[model samples]
Target: MTFDRPHDLLKRSPANPLIVPEQVRPSRPDWRVDCAFNAGVVQVGDETIMLVRVAESVAASAPGELRVPLLAEDGAGWRCTVESLRRDDPAYDFADPRMVVLRADPAQVYLTSMSHLRLARSTNGTDFTIDDAPFLFPSTRYERFGCEDARITAIEGRFYINYTAVSDLGIATGLAVTDDFRRVERLGLIFSPDNRDVCLFPRRIGGEYWCLHRPAPRHLGTPEIWIARSPDLLHWGRHERLAGAVPGGWEASKIGGGAPMLETDRGWLQIYHGVDAQQRYSLGALLLDLDDPRIVRARLGRPLARPAEPYEVTGFFDNVLFTCGATIRDDALYVYYGAADRVMALGTVALPELWAAMGV
Candidate 1:
């Protein structure tokens, strides 16, 4: 609760990972995005865009054999192999730094984590530019195994975006609207598999349309947070499971809801992240029901931020903290996370007074 901010807003970025891939695969290496992500801010004419969530990964030398090699134009440059992989299948599972459950073939798996939706820009909220192509890729078929953590609300006039799609027919929830992020307007595979961190509740209540999801139950427990209903935020429904897992503290190993929830006044604040009992990762706060956002009027046993810096204690997946986007403006909020999955940083705190010191 003492997070005051500024010390250069948690320093250390001697260009740390900054943006990888000069050559890995034909050309699209890895931008890696899952947590500490962002999307939708837009002003365009004046500045402040931010669409990030790259995650590309495709490199191989000859060692274990999982290819993505390319570069055959015939004008001279050639490598070939286009695509051909196998990490032993069985719904796949290769762990260590590159973490890939890719579902080798539960019946038709097709995800290997390649997401794409880049572009950073910024004019007054610290320096940034990014964008070398990719405003959203992996086109259709529930993202063909790409796209992750995207939030971005805006509503009514466009800019919906609710992400995390993965493939092989699992881990769903996808939608895309966009206004000027160039173009995006997919809205496929609403919510399936074990679901994902959703959000989407930036207006509309009694009239329907609400979101916030999670649903990862397969051993029965943790990964809670649900709630549905929609007159058309893309069909939705009355689902409702709403928050769980605060039981013995720091989220007892499950908790979600980050970004796009924030309504204020004293409810619908939500800035979740929890996961403890050694899974580390923090940041919490909840206060729903701005007209039944699934009730849960207040909760925040601890953690408004944790993972005590070192660029969030090491990278490419270390003791991470994760966020996926945030942006309040004036009184400060900013928060953009994604440190240990390797890179992307910018944190801030001050709005709703960090949710009344998390006793919200």
Candidate 2:
């Protein structure tokens, strides 16, 4: 199958930003939604479900006060901390819009908003109905900061969710299991601090479970994707480097796993996201050996999807195209992605064409 544009393998939906912040009411009356993005997508019955990450900011009336939600010492709920700063405050540093840092002590930083997962459903894979209430929130000390991107993998008739849990300590991966989306069984933090983007394979391989994750260093090393194996889903081991950013491309800065791996006749087809020096994010692919997923069979030299459209190039965070979920149906791939870290969008590509493009 030949494509008109090689990099345009995925076709964006006309109904872009299927779900936005305005469509979802904040979990609390005093909070206003800032953005909704980076959702985990799955197919259930006849509907396509998305677990969306919704960031909310506190409604503030005070002129100079910044109220941020942080995990309370008890580790079960959130406590808002108010920081009043003046433009001339020598100790205050406001370089990043996402965070407020202390000039005197760089270690002291606070987030501008809090994020939680919300449920959205669509029957046609384009138009969606967003839930008013949050499906998952910062319920634990580890998740006190918030729960960001979620990746859902179905195995043995159950769905496993792996999400980034943020707190004062740093970022970690948290796991949850559900038979039905109604109730989730929390598995606490599976991967320790300084690690995230944990995506599990659908089934056991070589008599063990496998997962792809990114271990980000605080100061020294670059963020790259790694593969690990485990007998139980809770404890992971035997970590090995999967892929890294290739300098001078859209993925020069860092790369991480995107959607859950799709089993194909060629091998395990995995989609991942990469960021460049300019902080632009794009989607790429990798083919792994069926027997040993750690072995990379092939990789796409170029990105399959990039930030080009109006909605994709501008928003909360500009030039970002991140995805955590995708579903296969009727010989086509439905990819649900977060555009510019502000809203959810959908894209599609023929399955056989995608496989052919990979050249595996």
Candidate 3:
């Protein structure tokens, strides 16, 4: 599909939806790429590399049945398996697109599509070539369900990767670091269960590493953005509530950290996504204090960009414009987002134009 600038604040790329499921090769022949989006982006040398989150399901399933992929814990690491369930069965409920839960035992659940991280490289930040093999797949216990939505922050010559790890225990943020993309050192789970959408600051602040994350509230508070500090990037502490969903606003449902923050003379510029009651997702900005990132200085009253085009309005999951990463080059901000949870797309916004919109 052609990428037209449906919204004026952020110009959509003509090559929008640059990466689609068809372009991505499945890890197994029996598996199929359901969607490719919500990628973590970084710049290595002259190439812009994206750690794309690719969700896959079985190639075929019997009529009136749903087949889901499972990674069994084998002594040698893991073995891929599939589970078939009768859709008409009263014991199962498929109310959510992401997972299926047993009506009797709510704890017992299976993901509709297994997710993994793959590499996609581009020299000019537009055209990309996807890697053949899986860059990071399910292996350990935390990643039994699969790893999803990677956020890359290059610090001290090494890229510190934060992503979502799904399993039976609950969803949490997982950390990993890599000097080269070929090999990664998994640091295990950093945030506790019932939390995700972690984005780290590029450098140290006041001798401590800082990050923004979202914790899913069970029965009390609603899902909101929170900040934390770490002395060694391993053990995090000093947690404080940053921001929450704006009631009766565009992001009235929930809000979470998006692309990594960019340090600027004004403050730390951050891009975040929010959902309303109708589940329409939109991108907004938050300006944090340069020294104290916990202090939110300015915020965009309106959406920077939202689902307008047909590609964004309909797909595997509709009306979503989620971004895991973005880059600023020569004063232009390039945002890589997943449109309707089906394909990867790029949006460009001049820094000056964005600043004017933010009134900062």
Candidate 4:
């Protein structure tokens, strides 16, 4: 499938990138924000609440030196430690701007930056006010590397958040819920290593809770969207593939769940991201059977949105548009997306237009 930067059908906010790295204050004085994006958004009362991922680089060091932040095992727990390594050390490789790898031991890869979730508040859903400190910082051994991209699912009177936890152990998924954004109750690691991009359904179905997750492949099989159910929110089982990538298609490389599924009259509307051969990220829609979510009722043949504008085409990782959460207001679907994994932006489409786009 030829992408050629397919134009997104939604109407973008004139404000465009509503939130940037500079607008946020790093948790530590020595750290500087690299990028702030991939926020999990929700509408609470009259304000739009956003939990944005903010990745920061350590302060510059002496000439020829590199500072590597690590979580060292401290007896029964872990503690933050910074190690200094020569930039030109023969034992290390820094080809990728995202990380530094020990040449002889690739598994000893270290991120050049650490990410934390920041809370931002908006009244009109466009302009935002970012908090001075990180809303959610990496503290557990599982999140030694950092806590990144979060997806929110509001159920009952509380908000359920499933986020990616990065560590040397492996990329995994964790769960946390909040009554107010101020304090949270962590449920620890919900999905094992090499699994992420998780979203919990807003409500229970068939007297059980459901979630969408992506389990990565190391040696065999391809990365695809999968579904799981749980009696209690902490444990998940009964896993099955919900959607897979299409070879030579728009989603030829891989596909993963995006915003939590939106319930409609016809089915559960799910927004997901697709990566092509060039690693370009775009958005698509999948309508799942209302009663049986495992059944895919209809799918959007083309991307609902793709990297087109300057923001989407350039940044830390170019040609990417990713959304962790979306909300509906006055029949309009508000899509909060991250541009090139660098900044946060918003787009909107009428519910009717989206339904027609998917031909459902």
| Model 4 residue 125 distance off true place after TM-score fit, in angstroms | 0.3
Off by over 4 Å in 1: 1-56, 61-113, 116-137, 141-145, 150-173, 176-186, 189-205, 212-230, 235-282, 290-305, 308-312, 317-319, 323-339, 342-360
Q: Quote model 2's TM-score.
A: 0.94
Predictions: Cα RMSD each: 19.9, 3.2, 2.3, 1.8
* Ranked by lDDT, top first: 3, 4, 2, 1
Global lDDT of each model?
0.63, 0.85, 0.90, 0.88
Cα lDDT of model 1 by residue, 1-360, tens digit: 122332332233344433333311222443223332334344344566666676554544355555432223334432322455565545555554344445533433333336566767767644567667777666555555567767777777777877787654567878888787777778686888778888887678777788888889888676878888878887887797887776676688788777777676677776768787777666666788687777887775556667666656665566565666666667656666666655566667776666666555
Better of 2 and 4 by lDDT: 4
Where model 4 places Cα greater than 4 Å from the true spot, the runs are 1-5
Better of 1 and 3 by lDDT: 3
Minimal lDDT window, size 10, model 4: 1-10
Over 1-360, each residue of candidate 3 has an lDDT whose tens digit, in order, gives 223444558788998889999999999999999999999999888999999999999999999999998788778777778889999998888999889998764468889999999999999998999998888888777777889999999988999889999887789889999988989998888998998998899999998999998989898998989999998888888999998899997799999999988887789988999999888888988999999999999898888998887779888989889999998888988999999999999999998888888887
lDDT of 2 at 15: 87
Full ranking by TM-score? 4, 3, 2, 1
How close to the true structure is residue 225 of candidate 1, measured as C-alpha lDDT?
Answer: 82
Between prediction 1 and prediction 4, the one with superior TM-score is: 4
Per candidate, the number of residue pairs that clash is: 11, 0, 0, 0
lDDT of 4: 0.88
What TM-score does structure 1 among the candidates reach? 0.30
